[model samples]
Target: MCDAGLKLPPNNEKLQREEEEVMHGANLTLKLNFPQYQSEVEELSVKSSTEVGYVKLLIGQRKGITAKNIRIFYNGTQMIDPMSLCDHLGVSPPSIDVDVYINLEHTIDV
Candidate 1:
């Protein structure tokens, strides 16, 4: 995926007429989602939460791997089952590519 290369939003107190129109137009537009394979995501697990594809790419750019391989593990032991990897990772299929969802990261649930 290409980086969104999104620019910063205008500060609320200083929007010009043109800036206001652009911001409103952007808000009115729709976004699309792209599906990802469960098998593909599952294949990259260094213990579910960690993805091998991500690691491989990182390693290729860093220390290095000659075989171009990936492995899964539960806790510290090796795992071959996709279910095992997914169970720990909670991966969902047909994932959303673009999100308009609100961020709840800093919100307290209690």
Candidate 2:
């Protein structure tokens, strides 16, 4: 219990490191192509179990935009399920490429 009467979780660095190491093993390298933005391409590494919405969040952070404005596509099909895992969407194995499209109104050249 802390001074505020709230129980704090254990700050075990070793446990956190172990968990990170485990997750690292499942990381997938993805090639992101921005066809709507000068045909720009970027590589990103994420966990295989990562959700589509989280991918948008990651890209949004780098592009200074919100996740809601980003759209991800695979195999010429738009990934509509934000909660779907990347691997399940067939965007895994590190060889598949993902297409990212941003709304023209909110597009930022980056």
Candidate 3:
């Protein structure tokens, strides 16, 4: 390996591009309309697996229902679980903070 006598050029442009990519994640809009759950949630942080669990538990408390029925949507994709969802979307699970939708079925209009 080269010592202090030699150094490689830094890639400032590459680093900047990476940072911009990280901030380019999409936002989701959840529409939770369960009458029993009067709690309002404009955003939910989901950055990790634990955060996913936290969201699931939080939903249970607010909606008085289990997490099984909870499904998240972003763009045209359906987030069914924490791992697959986060990995596929390249988004920190916790960074997902948009209006949380409840009791609304996802559909595509003609």
Q: Can you give the TM-score per candidate against the true fold?
A: 0.22, 0.66, 0.40
> What tens digits encode model 3's per-residue C-alpha lDDT throughout 1-110?
75669676687987775565466433333343333346644444333433344565677666666665465555545555544334545444335443344544422223
Q: Which stretches of candidate 3 lie over 4 Å from their true place?
A: 1-40, 51-54, 82-85, 97-110
**lDDT of model 1 at position 62:** 34
6-60: candidate 2 lDDT, tens digit per residue: 6866899977866874665356777899998776999988776677888898999
lDDT of each: 0.32, 0.76, 0.48
Better of 2 and 3 by TM-score: 2
- After superposition, candidate 1 runs with Cα above 4 Å error: 1-50, 70-74, 77-110
TM-score of 2: 0.66
lDDT-based ranking, best first? 2, 3, 1
Tens digits of per-residue lDDT, candidate 1, 45-102, equal 1332334344334433432332144333334444333232233443333231121111
Q: Lowest-scoring 10 consecutive residues by lDDT in candidate 1?
A: 26-35
lDDT of 3 at 85: 35
Per-prediction RMSD in angstroms? 19.8, 8.1, 9.8
